[model samples]
Target: MINKLNKSYWENRYVNNQIGWNIGYASTPLKTYIDQIKDKSLKILIPGAGNSYEAEYLWCHGFKNIYVLDLAHQPLDNFIIRLPNFPKNQLINADFFEYENSFDLIFEQTFFCALNPNLRTQYVDQMHQLLKPKGKLVGLFFNFELTEEGPPFGGSVFEYNSLFKHQFKMNVLEPSINSIKERQGKELFFIFEKKS
Candidate 1:
């Protein structure tokens, strides 16, 4: 089994500034997708939200029902500092596996790949339980091979489909055309809706 990446493990990553996956701004593909979303009232959740630039972008664009959850307090604190007026209650510091809520939309940034491979199934189940009927899970998924050594572990289309298909009907799962230069060919932007 892969080593558990528990709260302290992640909190220390933040404390030591070891988060290499933090892109200072919202990802281009997700931002473009957000630009086309007409529903400002959608109850959106960004789980594993590290120093959430995407949540900041959503708030700036008038999406008021955004929930930003992270296991570590450091990043959440950083986020609140950046957007002091954002609803404090909406910033959750908790384990995704235990959090309960039904969201209209859930944004997946680097969350999936960061968990230990053994928890992938639990991650899928938790995500399935977190979305309202017909709600969508949207965001970028890294496309590459999985390896033992990674906080940024990798995966592919087949693995994603197998894990999500039982609960979500994939609406779109294809190479992201607008990935940032650094991730140009390594990300797949997807939209998967709950099967209910």
Candidate 2:
């Protein structure tokens, strides 16, 4: 049976223009994290990356080895229009779970919360598998209660700690101090390195 939250569900969301999770620009916490990274050549992946402003920022900052993957084509097309010079090959249209690749870093935004709660473990495991040794998975996660009525389902730091600790070294997981004004205090910034 196809998962209820599979491609069709997400595609419909894009088709209907119901992407409230899209912040329309590189979010502050993520931008700050990317700003301090000294290396410009690190391979990076941003899955479930709807109209990925972060990818655009990275590309503009000379991070050419950046990939933005999404199941729907609309956002990818929007990204292409927004950054016509961005390498076409790096705009991936694929399922995050089935996508196969290794990266120096992967960014998490609202992607995790958009997924079904039952898949949290799989999300963590896939993130581990997709990273190179010492690779980092970094971004913001919602800091609140999880509920069925959400694509923006919330989560807590304690839950994140237990989920990621076994496969990743939790380098940072704390309430985001620099989130966009609306998300401030309701999100946690995290950086988790794959456990060798």
Candidate 3:
């Protein structure tokens, strides 16, 4: 049976503490990318931001306009507890596709892979819609086989390229050089600029 990775599904995972995807800290690849961004005022969104270590990292590093969105309330709750000073308004508990707001940058961590594979098209479209013109969608994507057995579903480089080629200008799609040990060679780092 196809696992419909919906809100309830995710909420249950958090309730059960079955989140193997939670790395407990901002991923090295994302941190390295965030470090290079010179625009501190960029409106940034981190969807499916479980534990939101990246959001915490961004806020701590002076990125004031950061937003953290999650389908499940458990993680967002944890984040608020961890970073109480973070703006309560920026902690969004909502479905990503339904959340309407344009941002200069969106950080993709496990969000795409966590969704059901059938939503790939919708994910791309929503991402395109959510980004400002010439804005970027940057992060790591798993470079593994796509199968029915996972919320951490995977896709090949060719598949990702084809799915995003039409709307995003490929700026940097390649093997991530600074992935954490657990994800060493399994992820593809990408920086896709929304096509103008």
State each model's CA lDDT, in order. Answer: 0.93, 0.91, 0.93
> What is the C-alpha lDDT profile of model 2 across 85-155, one tens digit per residue?
98999999998889899999999988998888888999999999999999999999999898778878888
What's the distance in Å from true for residue 13, model 3? 0.8
Stretches of candidate 2 exceeding 4 Å from the true structure: 1-3
lDDT of 1 by residue, 69-170 (tens): 999999999999999999999999999999998999999999998999889999888888999999999998889898888878899999999999999999
lDDT of model 3, residue 73: 96
RMSD of each: 1.0, 1.7, 0.9
What's each prediction's TM-score? 0.98, 0.96, 0.98
Error of 1 at 50 (Å): 0.5
Ranking by lDDT: 1, 3, 2
Poorest stretch of ten by lDDT in candidate 3: 1-10
- TM-score: model 2 vs. ground truth: 0.96
